[model samples]
Target: MNNMSVELNYGYNGAIQPYNKQFKSNFSGFNHFEVGIRYMFSEHLGAKIIYKSDKFVNDPGGNIGIQYNSLGAGVVYNIGKKIGLTYLTRDNLGLLFHLEGSVGFANSLIQQYESEKTKIIGIGITPQYRINNKIAITTDFTYNINLKQLYGFDGFPINTTKISETGSFYNLSIGLIYYIGENKYHSDWY
Candidate 1:
């Protein structure tokens, strides 16, 4: 069985902290996109690779924005019947929980900074509804934490002391998914 699936998604991304009220900064609406490939090694366990791009912007009259690019690999935990089995069974509709840790590089146009490596940890949940044997609609809610120090305009430090500081964001997305070499195998369909 080919236990592989690929997904393409687009959504809104924004920062949850350090909003810089003074500048009234925020994020560009619908400014994030992601591509992920998931391989189910076992029935209830697997791994996935993801790449995401996020762009932040300020409100009208504000002059601060940042862009984040990240690549992550993480463990995938499937939730459904055959939960304890090593071989995964496809369900027409199912839920998945994922936790991932990643290290990526960032660049800031406001501060004239080059590529700087940063660490991040993310946790998210995905709910999928199959449309047929190979197509489905999926929604994901994810939160990410930046583990390295963050800087703002003029090269000023925003979050100092690296891991000690708090720099985080959240994403809410909905997209379509296509499964390869698989059929709707949910218990409900049988």
Candidate 2:
């Protein structure tokens, strides 16, 4: 059989907050979209490439937004025909992190400001369970490194915030897969 597959993912990101609430920066809640293609070398081995995009609004006053465009390539290993595990290496194609704080008046002076523009590369892993021929459940965990911190209105200059400590950020997702293909029939197997 020609074991090639294409998958698409649609999901949402919840729990949008900074690791430390004292930082006064947080991500906006948003929907995510991903598309990928996989080629199976055998029932036990395969490789895939994927692209993803995310958009959202931020907090504290001015609109906060984050955009992630990434390309990931990975290998998959199946446990029998019912379950599989995958490891991926992802590169952040483009990333933007923005934060804006509340404006104020001091002695008849008004201040306004916003922070923007940050990018990085990352890696991830995914584990999936197939319930049957056409349906499966999947989850993923991802971590990014050397990312620029969110811009602050009065604290840091553009691209001057503390760089993300390596191995500092990660994401988890759970979702379903629907396969579309014609089932093959073999006379000898029957």
The models' CA-based lDDT, in order, is: 0.69, 0.42
The residue ranges of model 2 lying beyond 4 angstroms of the native Cα positions read 12-25, 28-30, 60-62, 79-122, 146-168, 184-190
Task: Please give the range of 10 consecutive residues that has the lowest summed lDDT in model 2.
Answer: 101-110
Per-residue lDDT tens digits for candidate 2, residues 86-175, read 222111111111111111110100124343334434455555555555555666555444244443222222244545322123445555
Clash totals for all candidate models:
4, 1
User: What is the overall TM-score of model 1 with all chains considered together?
Assistant: 0.80
1-190 per-residue lDDT for model 1 (tens digits): 4567887888988677655557645554677788888888765677889998877677664345766788999887777434522134344566777898877566665655555667889999887777876677889888988876465321235655533355788888888776666554422122
Of the candidates shown, which would achieve the greatest lDDT relative to the real structure?
1
Error of 1 at 167 (Å): 1.1
